[model samples]
Target chain A: MPVNKPFLHGQFAKRGIKAAKGITGIAVLFIAWQIGASVSGVSSYFFPAPVDVYNAFRDMMHKGILEVYLLDSLYRYVVGVFLGSLVGIGVALALGLNKAIAAVFAPLVGFFYAIVESAWLPVFVIWFGYGITTILTLLIFVVAFPILYNVLAGIQTLPIVYVNAARSLGATRWQILREVILPGVLPSIVTGFRIGAGFAFRGLIIAEAIAATSGIGFLIFDGAANKQTDRTIVGMIIMGLLWLIIELAYLRPFERATIQKWGLVTTAEQREVQ
Target chain B: MIVNKELPKISVDNASIAYTNQDFAEPHLAVKDVTLEVSANEFLVVVGPSGCGKSSLLAAIAGFLTPQGGSIKLNGKQIEGPGADRGVVFQDYALLPWKTVLDNVGLGLKFRGMSKAERDKIAREHLALCGLADAEAKYPHQLSGGMRQRAAVARTLANQPEVMLMDEPFAAVDAQTRMTLQEELVRIWQQTEVTVFFVTHSVEEAIFLGDRVMVLSSGPGEIKAMVDIDIERKDRDLSSLNSNPRFQALRDEITRLVRQDAA
Candidate 1:
């Protein structure tokens, strides 16, 4: 046991270091691919070399094409998520607060949630025509369901004592929602938002590619049509990079901070102490 | 029988509680035909074995559960729903996890429509009184078991309820912490003049804390015996009272009553 104690601690340290290296190793692989492509002298026709894509990226930036498309994509993403989240949360809260509302809407939300967001693209395009309205609405509809459903469940599942305590202290229904229910459901809502954002991003890109032009999606599709693989590669790279930035630099950090601050993630020790 | 003629802060008259769920063969009768009068500012502790309906009586007083028969009147106003006039400290701390200690304490004040500053001031006073001033910014999870219960006490106390109904509030804490909390509670009750109707399973806790201890019989629970502690309120600290022969006698008597009721 004495020998095994040090061995186990050492094993843990080694595993921690390996996990860190593995993450950086993935970035290293991407760098290696870029170098290999540039050095191999592969003509820009086939898998367009990394330098070719970089040049294409630079040209688009210089022409202000990149900025315009990026801004448009961002706008759609933000607006769609915001509007979708509002409706989803509102409906979820309504359902969570009243059983009658839940009985009426839960099945409807469940059925729609099972249907993929892309399935609506064709109908939306037919109804609204190939425009921002169709894309944004589709994205919102996709994102809204998950957020509402998860939030509703989370709010409903709160320990009965929490509400009873509040009511005993003279908290009105509104106060209970604002003070207790909202905070209780927030982490799950964020989880739903993360899931929703992934879908919205996918939906936005698909919508852009299928119809009117002006996004990273359009950039890739148009580049492929024109047989400019360099442009296509650059578009793909930018899409990955931007989504990574949003997810890691923005969304992940926000979620982590929120969970740290207000999360009810409890351990056995904390429960015992409390 | 010269019942103390002081105005009853709470009057329970032939109250019986039965759960109205559909699946049961018979409605679960938690308490049956129980009547007691809690005097103004009196520390009345009800003790019984598990399932003896001590907590049910407290719940009825708190208006969390409606009695199927008879009534509970606070100064003769029938309690139809929960009100701020009667604060409750549950066995489980029940502090809102998302709320800071200060916010949790001030929750009732917020409902009363007090200004943030006013609520903060009152919350701070109660927090300080509960010896939790340093923990005002902490969440319930960060606090110790004793601290959380103290915070609960502070939260209830901050509401300034005329009658405080505590359902085994110290049961969740350890023995040492429990003893400390009992002393603090007694001190608070003395200072505030708030009537406390406490329910406990422990006979020693009942005898140590209560001005009058009521030993309740099991299921369809009734008051089997009542003993009034004549110890001077100021001298009734946990240590001094634990060693007091009369405290021991009352504890033994209540223990015997509860055990006999259990049999």
Candidate 2:
């Protein structure tokens, strides 16, 4: 079999435009930061210039603090995302397949959904005691809700004809679930996961700062307290770089491979008109 | 056209259907006291107006919808549910968006527990018959509207169903494509021994494709007329069929019956 290109059909040029725009934005920000610092005549200890922040990042790298922090933060975030998605999709599929389960869980889940993950932090802190466990729980809670709702909404939006067609073609219940239902809701599931992951990312920073002793969030809080504002700026830069890497390496490529390739999943707006 | 008086492939005895999901207080009755007997190898075309319950009738036969009253049977046995023995082609084509043409055609047989190699051979043959010979690897979205519908027909046929239920299968295409598809359907029908129950809203389409066209009234679809096309099977070509007087007569009759009662 022939191997297809990872980025085919002019996708390289498509993403290139986005990448160029993003890089330009950062470049302009950095240039302005340098001019602003000189113009303001502010102390570097209060707000670090781009060059000062870069020096602090290098200094931290040499001391191996930033490397260890990066690993710790990434580990918790990745594991939390994985577990949360699995549970969310599993629960959604279970509820979607049975009306009784949906009816029983709908209001209960909705009630819990209204209570933000941040609200659970104080309670989780009491339970898990200000460590990876508390922070991870908050991350999972943040990620799972959006994924669960998206999966449920996706299953509901599917047209009945797809199921009817497959059934008439001699598919059993299991076959319908596997072949028709799963594939039909996949775009929505992925879309939901993306939204959930984005929400969880914001929650991750807050959770890490309050709970964990290691991680970029820990570094930011620690820098603010110890009069190391340059290190705080370094942590911020790393966070931005991490996000860019995740999108370019994971989410964008994953979407390109599946949803964009199929081009069949219509959004809610497109579906209404159709 | 002489429909052989052999065993009936499908028999709908006094079937009635109603849509109960509407917000209105009264249930909307679709078809009432409708009974149909389609024999083996018979090409039966059902024609009706917009509000007619022709689709509901077809759906009941395909085991997608249940009749409010009466029973539907296949070869003297009751149809418990949807089975591999009866295949349906939907108006949207219902081709799996993710699957390629070859895979979609072979999928029905796969569900019947047929080996991959065996189903693939059967699928390839049917795809060729439907004039989709070289397009097996292409996805449904890659194909034209006409090609997608043809693939749908091929997929249903490859299942080797005794009866093929088609509900407005060509209604989504353009006029040019619709005519070509109607012609292709006739050619394919002649090549296979399977019985077909095709429902359409077009009067001319009914005359062109069906061995016997059955017309139903507007609402609560009741059989208003059944006309047997006397034209030879070979004369169904668009060029020749246009000039055929009997074909025109049948079209006019079905049109009048469908447009009856100011509907």
Candidate 3:
């Protein structure tokens, strides 16, 4: 089976109603924001109306600044996350597969996990000095830790039956890893990606706020520096919208397909929704 | 007993199973040195109390574990590791939950380099043999415990292994289903000519299925006795064989051995 057939038709129809209700809720929020801004008569520097933020988005799109910054931010997000997750999984398998290696690295992983992202910014800036390398390196370490930890936990949690069954079926060590271990842990890996992606996005913005010349984060700084609250609010809204779209359109479907194929998710009722 | 002149399928020599734990926990030997031979197309059942290493003995023969000492050989060749010639059915009906009945049976064929059509053809044949043809589209969770184990048996049979190792494969199901499965299994075993080494704690199950029942004692399991079941051999009518006086006598003998070992 191709495994990617669109979910049952009933799912689409049901979601259509849910989507309609969600849109109605968003509309109410938009109206409230507009009315509150108008009544308060706040300076544009303090609070921009939804209309003013939309107009700023339109103006930035025309100037092409929004496109450049958004593209730049996306490129970094992709590169940093990809590199981070790869290194994370490798280390996780190393530690998960062997007790000796786990003992050596567990303490180091724990120590770094305790140091918050914000605290690392000063040290990283001092070491690499304001550029893509420094930002990406910081994002890699920050994003890699949790993914590594979760993957290790997932490996440890694997049922003994899977290994015994696979081995009995004539699967060699490498074959067991390729067919059984990897597939078994893939759901947790995706879960790690979901969590790590969130952290990496936050780290990217913080890094950009201090270092980058362009990006959504740079736009926030640029707007605030110029006292253009409309542009800053637009940037923030765009960031939130992009994350929502990526999760819904890409990551969520990918996670569901993998979890289903691996037979990890058992509830048939909920699977129909996938 | 009709004995065809053929080489013994597998031979075990003084095998002892022990565990050593340095960093993790306490270590203990579970099964003492044991020797046995299983002939081609023979049904050998090993029965014992809990913690007797009945499962471990099966695991050793399946190459999932290395004995602390002693050797296992297949048709004059030393058994090095798990191979396609041997297939195992587990107690838990370890059917891949993600795969439909059809795909689960076809998985071994996939590894064998068979074309999809060939794999599907062979899988369908086995599924039909187990009376699961109509349920090919259903997942493991959709099937009953009996049906799940039937699918598991079909999966092992699809690989065309020369020997089948079953570790309490019917223990998890209800009595009615277990009886049905046992009858169906004997029918399949007769038709396929596959040698079977079954492990169980149930003496009735052992006497009901085996040509020879090997009894093992508790912890550090060792062969206590072997009883030959030479009851009427109407292979297809195994469902009624339960009522045979000879079968009952053999069952009682094995039960006495188990109780004696426990005492």
Candidate 4:
């Protein structure tokens, strides 16, 4: 009647345990880093202590530098990832639905996939120059590739039964794409999103460090140049925490609700072997 | 509705299907020169050994495979591809896992441009008919194997297809559940004037459920024999299937034909 309440309750309990483990794991790492710094007798500039880093975080927060940089980095990341994933999924559907178009783009996609992010960086800088345009463009370019590959893979890996059953039910081509293909590929889309989000984070930092004037990446660089190691350490910790929070709060729950929880759609590569 | 009692619903005329290969491997022949006919509203069951190409034959009828040799026709019109008039229940109950039972059942209706409320109402009716009254909101994975198959059946029935193609729809279920589903399927078949082409490996199941049973030979499947059960007019009693003398005779005859691999 209600789709098995006990299973849902059990999943909740498992999630609690997983969250506890994650918290404990982060706490242990922090403690180890503090101990290692103290034992090595490293200068505060070389390796700032936990308290020093915490104080730096507090000072930056008070001065509002942290807030501006954090917001700047997050805004770029959010917009870039969203735009890139949209383009990626669009291309994937194109390739998936039609073989002739896929044949034409297959080699191009492969070649572009082989090109490194840095390879495009130099040319992009020349075209867009050092500013939000260059950074945003670079971030989107880098983020879109992985999602494109992943979504394409998702499309290819879809079960044949889904298509056959839908067609048998008299679904037209467009109807099949919307009703069957879209839902079938969503699990892989989310997987690609997680992977692409990770790439976006790295791309954001790199783009900021090289092209933009303010961001977490800029903070790390600015601190090093200005001999504010504590601020750099603060930046590093925030980046890790931000990614961790996003993963736990958004990506994971979305996956759980859509794919893993539904218990259908393997989305794994093995299903595509045929 | 294509409900003409005198016309054959689907006709297979000397159709042969071969699977081609791109590599050095030899192309395989799955079904060879198979011929059969299903009249309107007839529940025709097909039984054969493994690798008999029963599934391939069914797929050809569903328009997933094209015949290399002859042709298939529906209502005197040569079959081109899959259509709404012919609904298929796959061996593995191909319910879209993302959708709830209600959504999956109403999927065909959605394609037909029925409003959501009307589709859901029709879906609910079929679900109830299949003894899944309370499972309309449950996702496919949430249901047991028997329930999943039932939902698949309901989904097909809701589409109101003229011909129902079932590829061993109960093979995945346990014996008890299979028997129950078989009985339920018979009851549903009797209620509607829909023709059914059911494929199964079990002789007992074929005899218990079919008005006529078609037996196919192994490897590159061809018709071995076609047996009329003659029990369609009798009281349908699945529980006494094993003990019924006529049921046993039919089962034995079909089993013997299958064991010989030819009539």
C-alpha root-mean-square deviation, each candidate? 6.1, 3.8, 3.8, 3.6
Instruction: Please give, as one word, the docking class of candidate 3.
Output: acceptable
lDDT of 1: 0.85
**Candidate 1: stretches off by over 4 Å:** A1-23, A35-43, A266-274, B1-6, B20-27
Q: What is the Å distance of residue B178 in model 1 from its true position?
A: 1.2
Q: What is the TM-score of chain A alone in each candidate?
A: 0.83, 0.90, 0.92, 0.90
Writing each residue's lDDT as its tens digit, candidate 1 over B1-263 gives 55455668899999998764576678888888988998899899998889888888888888889999899999877889788899999899899877899999999999889999999999999999999999998888888999999999999999999999999998878999998898888888888979999999887888778889888889878878888977777666776777888777877777788899685
Query: By DockQ, who's the top model here?
Result: 4
Indicate the residue-level lDDT of B116 in model 1: 94
Q: Residue B70's C-alpha lDDT in candidate 4?
A: 94
Cα displacement (Å) at residue A48, model 4: 1.9
Question: How much is B65 displaced in model 4, in angstroms?
Answer: 1.0
Model 3 error, position B198 (Å): 0.4
Question: lDDT per residue, candidate 2, A199-226, as tens digits?
Answer: 8778787888889888998888899889
How large is the i-RMS for each model, in angstroms?
Answer: 1.4, 1.0, 2.4, 0.9
lDDT of 4 by residue, B150-212 (tens): 999999999999899999899899999998898899889999988999999888888888889
Give the best candidate by lDDT.
Answer: 4
Model 2 spans > 4 angstroms off: A1-18, A265-274, B1-5, B23-25
Residue A99 C-alpha lDDT in model 4 = 98
Please, what are the lDDT tens digits per residue for candidate 1 over residues A93-178?
A: 88888899889877987788888877888988999999899988988898898898789779868887888888888989898888
Question: Candidate 3 on B124-215: residue-level lDDT in tens?
Answer: 99999998999888888789999999999998999888899999999899999998999899889989989999999998888778999999
Q: Can you give the TM-score per candidate against the true fold?
A: 0.89, 0.93, 0.90, 0.91
Task: Supply the global lDDT for candidate 4.
Answer: 0.87
